[model samples]
Target: MAIARTWKSHSVLPGFGLALGFTILYLSLIVLIPLSATFIKSAELSLGEFWAVVTAPRALASYRLSFGAAAIGALLNAGFGLLTAWILVRYTFPGKRLVDAFVDLPFALPTAVAGIALTAVYAPNGWLGQWLEPLGIKVAFTPLGVVVALTFIGLPFVVRTVQPVLEDLEAEIEEAAACLGANRWQTFARVLLPALWPALITGFALAFARAVGEYGSVVFIAGNMPMISEISPLLIITKLEQHEYAGATAIAVVMLVASFALLLVINSLQWWVSHRHGRKQ
Candidate 1:
């Protein structure tokens, strides 16, 4: 009994029970309570009514665009963000700090401001827009514009997620692989990739989640065209404006469920990859 008391007093962090209780209470008050209210609001609709609200043609189109654009944005970020992080970590050049700072501009910029700036730059009469219009490319006020806006906002998530991982990795690993008669591609594919997989997956998931829930950054570029460029979040807001509270809550619930499901899958994948890599090492 004396030993048990000593061990308990010497624990690395005291009051685990207090901390756990506080965490549960905080989450319940801030997250669980609000989410439960959404379901309660939505439950006013009958089963068929709820089904129709979610499955309506307009809602379906919004779902497609929101998820599709978010996926595309996340994918593009996963590629370019990795490259950005690599360059920052692996090389030194003129204005390197400037470039690094620029990577985070999106995070600091307001979403509405981002949407407006992108619209101006991509509008048909604007700077790059004038040059691209003749090439049959339209960005402002279109679905493509939505993708651009999402990509802009989501880039930071990927870069920030992977940057630390890349920094922690030693460049000598690549040199070692080369000394073993491995080609560059082989070195990267077999040596660097496995270590980077978990971080990349996490970055992708973060960017994807951010893009899915994004509204202000997309609304201006999307042109708010129903069934074409409208996003689900925008649709929910519209329903709320129209006093269709139940419908709005229903849509919100669907988004909540779907986002949770996708995040869960991505997190599971990250865990599996990390576990496998650990076993191999």
Candidate 2:
């Protein structure tokens, strides 16, 4: 007798087909259609008009502040987040669980509340700010505040992204490397770094993307100083409030394009790393 083809016999595909249908429909309604509307609205602008809106000095400044601070914050997180993940994974101490739970505070805290709290803490007259301001270190209502807010929200991404990879890492390799006379730094650089590299990159990309369009946590602290501490999302809102829909969409389109290009590059890097790792395996 022939062996049974169980998947064919059960006719399970109908359920899967139904699930796939709903998934696409949901995505179209929520994501695709809205994005398509942005593209449509942007298409109304002439090429020169589009360029004028996107490349104007004020708009360019916003892009710099947004992407620049986000990149910096993400880089910081990648380094600190690795240490945090290592602490959570490699050891146990009193309050270790509490520290692990604290990592998720940003995720659970309302963005507006976090923004308010951060502004209060960092504002010139606020608690910590009182000390820093005397030394001419400005935090709130400046670009530095933007970096702080971005760092606050972006950290959880790096920590969460890296934690899982750290957990999955086998201790045996480290032991063997040590047994073969590898120092702690030597073993980590040679063995652990390669496996965690992809996770770190992914976390960095996640944090960057989250910080790019962040509005709620940034707006209250940014002071919305035009052409200076202003961010792109605020600019879009300002345009909308002034009923400049076309200008708003133009900026949105520029961000969409730039973000797409950035993500594509990051994804390509991730793919190369994964592929190379696979070949070694």
Candidate 3:
């Protein structure tokens, strides 16, 4: 008799092909089409013109401020967010629920409103700014202001991402490490951190992406001064206002490509870390 072959597959949901087809179609309509249009519009410019537009002094300055501020802000958020999440997960106190709810304020508040409030609090002669001015430190209308705004908006991302991971982490692991004669720092560094690393990276990438394209919040405090505190999104708007559509699209394309590349790298790192950790188990 001839040999026979058999295959079996299982899924809770039915019509897997149909569901996947719908997902791809929806994504293409919403995301792929718009992005393709942006690229096509930018393609109207010649190579030399595209290069000039992206490499202009103002454009270069905006890129530096935008990426630099975002990187600094994301890094700050990672550290502080981890601490915040740790406290929320490991300890309980009065008004704990209120404090947890407050973490999502940035997600709920309008960006314009947040910008106005930040400017009011940080501008020279404004509450905190008044005290800092005499110390020769400035916040509003400076690159530092941009970083502050980015940090404020991006903090929630890291917190939310890492919070769940921390909650799922059992306290017994720490106890076990201590039982093995590990100090507090050693327990954290050797046990907790490995499990949290992937989530932390994901949060950092999310924060960085959010900060890069932020416009409304950053514009108010940035003073819109070209080559000083202006950001890339603001620069794109400036180009658009001048009817330089091609130039605007060119800049947008650069931002899109750079952000995508950075996120891709971060995601790959997250996957690799998760895979290695899994193998160790």
Ranking by TM-score: 3, 1, 2
Model 1, position 85: C-alpha lDDT score:
94
Worst 10 residues of 3 by lDDT: 1-10
Residue 196, candidate 2: Cα error in Å is 0.3
Q: What shift in Å separates residue 116 of candidate 1 from its native position after superposition?
A: 0.4
What TM-score would each prediction reach against the true structure? 0.94, 0.90, 0.94
Residue-by-residue lDDT tens digits, candidate 3, 38-67:
999999999999999999999999999999
Kindly give the stretch of ten consecutive residues in candidate 2 with the minimal lDDT sum: 1-10
TM accuracy, model 1: 0.94
Which stretch of 10 consecutive residues in model 1 shows the poorest summed lDDT?
Answer: 1-10
lDDT of 1: 0.94
The model with the greatest lDDT is: 1
lDDT score, candidate 2, position 34: 99
